[model samples]
Target: MSDAEGSNEITTIENPYAYLERDFSSENFKIEVKNLPKFYGMNEFRKLLNEKLKLHSNKIKTTRKNSPYAFVCFRNEEDRENAINVLTNYKWKGYDLQILKAKPAPDPLVKKRKENAEDLHSNKKTKTEEVCSQEEKLKNSTIPYHNVEYDQQLKLKLEDIKKVLKKFGSELSRQNTELKNWIEKQKFLYDGLPCELLDIRFSDTTEGYRNKCEFTVGIDEDTNLPTVGFRIGSYVKGTTAVGPVDNLVHIPESMKVAVKIFQDYVRSSDLKVFDPEHHTGHFRQLMARSAQNQLMLVVGIHPQDLTDDQLSEFKTSIVEYFSVGKGTPAKVTSLYFQKIVKKNHRDDIVPTEHLWGDTHIYETIMGLKFKISPEAFFQINTKGAELLYKAAIELAEPSENATVLDVCCGTGTIGLCFANKCSQVLGIEVIPQAIVDAKENATLNSIENSDFFVGKAEDILGNICFKATGEDVIAVVDPPRAGLQKRAIFQIRKIPKINKVVYVSCNPMAALQNFVDFGRPESKKVHGVPLVPTKAVAVDMFPYTKHCELVICFERWDKISSKQLQSEELVS
Candidate 1:
């Protein structure tokens, strides 16, 4: 496709869905295919892989790595070599072949070694033993270095420390399995887990390990996705609400083992695995699978081991995979070479809108572009989000004159979704980029009755609605995993004339309980009236993940608006 340049010198090009549908075949070996433009979300790569697998023999497998560059694998080195040659020789997807000896898979005997090492459990402390003081900011402090020698010495220590830590950490992780199982065993003997959480999965990283689990207990009175601002919804990012722990509850041991097996399976797929934040590989699949937008294909590379140039190459290849437009024919370029030979490279992604011609709209259900950013929250499943919005609107029961508040509006999909049906919508978000995108999105859709504000929900919601309709105010809040802030809940409980609230929570497990706590007997009152929770619907936004989204409706059981909760809110 002849690409047109944008004002910013970013190129806009035709969509590559046509090329994606053409006949393609996988080289039977794990050859490294280099230098093609990636599609948004890496669909182009997936489409190519899918097309090749369909047209070619299934005996050979084409895989990707955590770096997300193509790595075709065969049953043996010979087939692998053959596949490598074909890929290197061909001009597929406008890129040239550059296959070489990728890091080989760890020997199968290593599995035996890992298993035997599990027996040395009581003798060593795992790296998980060195827990940072806090969860969010885990550290003593970042030490400043005066010289290159300091860096060299620390780098050496880092390797030794990593090895020792991983060894013991593995032991600790095994113990975690035992401990988690012991808890679950108690639950199985009885009816279920003693605590409200439904299930737990064990995961370990070089840094530490996390006990990922689900909770049955949920936020109270959550209904549909709240429409709190012009382009807003609810989702909490951090987890500060660690409740009191009760060890008396039983945990399931056998289930944990089975789950561990499943976890291992998920880690072996075509989806590349790595932490974009830490630049290390971690088996974060459990959480990744929870959202509709998250898709996991396991590649055999551990995230922590890729070299700097490899990382750059991986990022470029992955970015091309994530893009969806016609790729400029790949020739050896300074850019690709720099990626192929770099150190401490920071470039890992492309502004997808720029790469995909900026013409491709990130449309939600309403066909309005979503102001999605890398950091801003968007529904995990791009398509499934439509259903969620549709469901939220159904419960909001909007009229032409209804005023809507879309809180936690990451890119404003929910608010813009309901704008055509409502009188006006106000969207709120903490991300400046999101607010900018949300406003642009409204303009792009030519919708005038909506505007997005840049601020946290608790701070701006009161003033955003103060001058507006005291009645017919419908709030749709989709908070992050940590759930709503205490202040936001209080405001929801007491918002005068705002009797209807639709809560769309993705982290229904941990976050939902917060709402339940807020609406508990001791919670604040409406104008002299106490609040109550009303349950609604559970929508499976992610088909594969254990997590699900919930929409609940909260109506004032008492005659008071949340003005009564103001004193309690102030105390909090």
Candidate 2:
């Protein structure tokens, strides 16, 4: 039969052995190599397999874009098995290759000739549907531990801190002899620890404890409408879809209501939600902060070529809607408008204009009133913050004769809390606005002993009179999530009066380097006597989430003699 007639006959043939020559058995000769380097040309990859690896391959199949895995086809099963054995866990260009056997690719001609082509198409459809289902699952998985029991979630958080402390202890043991001896001495109080790891503490109320929430304005994948909530993932990964905040357990009901109101307002507005891809449109984000019965709403917009009059009209419409119109039900105490402009760096300051209502929101923690500004950095959980601050203060062990140095003090929350216990409280923050609020907060609470400076802690720590009117200065550092700057760590070490430091870190993994730097041997780059971890505690500031606060107390000790190092006194 001719080729065309043979193809027709194969399509109608019911015999199982029909078209035996087309059975490629490609699966037996193909291997999948994963964990590839992010950037590489196809020719270079082939050369690596052919010349460098001394393994000849017929062809390599890869995605259109740069993928982390690819399939290389050999001529025989022996070569394929050899390739797997050679490349499995093999280090290549700083990455370990994960090699495994791959399934065969269906030949298009065989699929067309087979009468069960519908089955092949059906299988493909099912796989596509499964992929879409997974995307939805990932998009909605904002609160990973929300469904978990509160007790189990707390334990998980505690375990995370324990791991961080354990790794830190190991690093300390390898860094210096004094630190190793110190860890050995402290082993009696806490097992497998460089310091005493205390029981984790948490607030009484765990659910709906968040005081502030920032919601993104973008298209929702589920509803295909404008949404105000969190993004599923990073925008750089092409995931601009915003998931609904209504289902999030950490957000308070007041914040969710505010989100709904703004979402509705944006949907009704003629302008479009700002697209991160094109950087166009008006609405960008909605920030909500609640203090008891009051709620502050800040509307962020991308003014994308809008006229002054148009911007004024847009601002007036939103102010009226939230102030007295349909959004009055939200009882927004403070309303502000901010133009969202893309920044060159993460720390770039963006100003907010008070469109209506109060200029700032107030919160009372530890009986001291704090004035919170829109741009100021405040803890998301209010009740949880009280527990966190309490733990930090306890670890700090403030005394009337000692001064408390509050580094990265936002609005003087921690410093003011320590003012009654310590002789004086000195705070340093980078944000000028937060410093303004900190001074006003001091005045509001009649906290006369505390003084806040407006500059980076590294720049102001040496210049400021931290040693004024005190026998000892305890540095209480509660820096941002990224941890303390190297210069700030250097400055903290240089000060001889700072014998004790209470380091509060929300992200202990990120702050591990800071902790290590404190105990590093004195060098030209790092000066002064080193401090070692003495005690640490975990605070469950964010329940139903993988986040918690870790407070570690670092203290200085005298160097031991070589004779003492050999004696039992070394463990003491």
Name the best candidate (by TM-score).
2
Query: Clashes in candidate 1: how many?
Result: 80
Residue-wise C-alpha lDDT for candidate 1, range 369-395, written one tens digit per residue: 654333346664555566678778877
Task: Give the TM-score comparing model 2 with the true structure, all chains together.
Answer: 0.75
The lDDT of each candidate is: 0.45, 0.80
Please, what are the lDDT tens digits per residue for candidate 2 over residues 1-572? 89999987755443333323333234447888999998665656887899999887867889854689999988687888888888999987899999989876644333433434455665644332345442344434556786689889888888889899889988877876656766776665587777888899988888788898878898888779998888876543335778787667778888888899888899999999986544567798888899978899989887878999999999899989988899988889999988876632233336888999988888889888888878878888888788888988888888788899899998889989999998899989988878888899999999888888999888889876544577588999999887898778889888888888999999999899889989888888889888888789999888777888999998875533333467766577
Question: If scored against the real structure, what TM-score would every candidate get?
Answer: 0.42, 0.75
Model 1 is weakest, by summed lDDT over 10 consecutive residues, at 225-234
Worst 10 residues of 2 by lDDT: 15-24
Model 2 gets an lDDT of: 0.80
